[model samples]
Target: MTTTIRSVETFRLRVPRDNGAPTERFRAAPRVRSIYPTADELLLVRIATDDHVGWGEALAPASPEAPGALIDEVFAPFLVGVDIAAGARPLTRRLQQTGRERGHLSGIQADAIAAVDIALWDLFGQVTALPVKTLLGGANVDAVPVYMSEVNGASAHAKAATAALLYERGMERFKVHLVGPPEIALAEYDVVRSEVGTSRLALDAHWVHGAGDARRLARGLDERGAWFLEAPLAPEDVDGHVRLAAYSGTSIAIGEAMRHRFEFAQWAGAGAMAIAQPDLGRTGITEAISIATIMGAHHIPLAPHHSMASGIAYAAALHVSAAVDDLLAVEWGPRIAERSDSFLDVAFLEPIGTSGAWIEGGVVAVPAGAGLGIHVDEEAVRRLAAG
Candidate 1:
């Protein structure tokens, strides 16, 4: 049986945010927080190995069309001839080799490589009859612990209400997205507290400050028993983060925008962040695991930045977090009954042996099925693909 990859296929899904109309979700938010988020876009890649099928996705937060074009014109042409059995690590190197000649893979180029590398790993797991995590290393646990992501709304009450709703649905922890100055953040934290009542809440500042503001907010979060503070300062300011970390009582989290291990190494070496959040779709499985190893050396936990990704990308993130020794819970965006118009949901993680959704009671199980352990609908993908 020829398990070598035969063809490459791609998809681009443009799901408008409520048909590009204003809604209570936005009108009720603390402020017009998101700057015209017209839609949520995703790019998916599929690889075939005679007997098995595998899926992957690039984290296309904005325009998937660009990465989609690059995957078709650039990466797919390079990878279609490769062997899945040859291995994901080397195949990743083969992809990066192009960047070495042309330019470093960043932005959409990095995303394209990620989609290809992840699909290769998924195919490898299918051929070997082992889950992707098992291939990386044993899944230290059956279910990867997760924290329910944001519940944004116009008012503090709205945000708290949204969090309460997810908690009723079996989520135990939450992350409140914050923007603006320190006073604005502290007030919202109080709102989150009044509603959730200290049930494991974390604050994502979204790069809202300098050393002084971050220290003030971190001090407040620590007093309230908040889990961690993310991106208090700019992404590249490692020394600034190190300075902030010295005074802040809360753990500092970072690495969502970073492209490689070297950047993470710089931050980790400086003891900047207590937790590292590497995006699986951005790093590809190859560099992501390497980044994990780098973070591990500094005794920093990897929480994995995950959002705007379809189920395929989420599955990849879960598998990596499962394999790594240090995971401080995965980030999940349930969106409180938000639209499910994207075809990506058709490929949600379906546990082979588990009874309920992969997510059950504030935790998600590492899918036991071979490969990424999810079912992707080919017909749906083709319909969603851009020309």
Candidate 2:
């Protein structure tokens, strides 16, 4: 039976916890910025078909409230009662068309559609009784490597301590976010590089520097054997990224800010990006796949972003990562995940434990079963939903 979308509901989940864990880690290193929120709220999109249910999440860091309203006000009205079993392609095209006409093709508009599109795909997978990885053909790797992302800290010593903890836990790949002068960032990088023992390292400057500084920072890290220099320039400056990527020969990772594949094509075609990090909460599964396919043609690896999302989106990313050929590693947010009010559980292959993301091994396995391959507690989601 072809399933029609019955309803679309967005639940805002916020849970209470110490939230100060990461902050305390940065207590001595005062210059480090906090990218992960304390007491973060996630907007979960739930789409129910005649019989099956599907789940999705919007990337609402800092607990932005606009995407949920956009879903209720705009996306739901258009998606409800639509037979999505044919695939979410047409509807997504229509939604983007509508957004273009209304001048909201990016930002919140894109985010709302992203969540809706993910739910639609989850519904499709459930109907077929196959994991999404299988639905997207088959996985290229059995388990994708995981990368721990966090504020590397204020001082070099502080940075080294954090790296030491993660390294002891078996995490070899890391993306460290550092703020302040390029020199300060380099200092922390040097200490971490020394402590981590020839491990893979990437730096995210959080758009704190420009092409010149990014060039300098890239050179410093390159000389020291860093994997990639990420987001040194602001996300909108594609040309700047292109120049840096070309000049430094260091693969630049971008795409968390990008909403669709067309944007990624612009970056990849320009040779601006070496790795693409589209957030599933922003591009969702449909466009994330499309973007990955575009990047794959360019031989760019996909390292899907996962800053502050809950477990639902993480599970979704695992399936997509497992399906792709050139996959680096999914960014893990132990800081955010600890208190993000993510509520989902399902029996999965323990090829890796802990939501298929084994922190100890720095590798995450694809969750098995149908749809998004997790059981969501909708009732708990509603209760946890913030006002």
- Spell out the clash pairs found in candidate 2: none
What is the alpha-carbon RMSD of candidate 1 to the true structure?
A: 3.7
| Candidate 1 backbone clash number | 6
Best by TM-score: 1
lDDT of 1 at 183: 86
Off by over 4 Å in 1: 19-36, 101-105, 335-361
What TM-score does each of the candidates earn?
0.89, 0.89
Q: How close is candidate 2 to the true structure, as a TM-score?
A: 0.89
lDDT of 1 by residue, 337-378 (tens): 232334544323422223433344477677778988876667
Model 1, poorest ten-residue lDDT window? Answer: 24-33
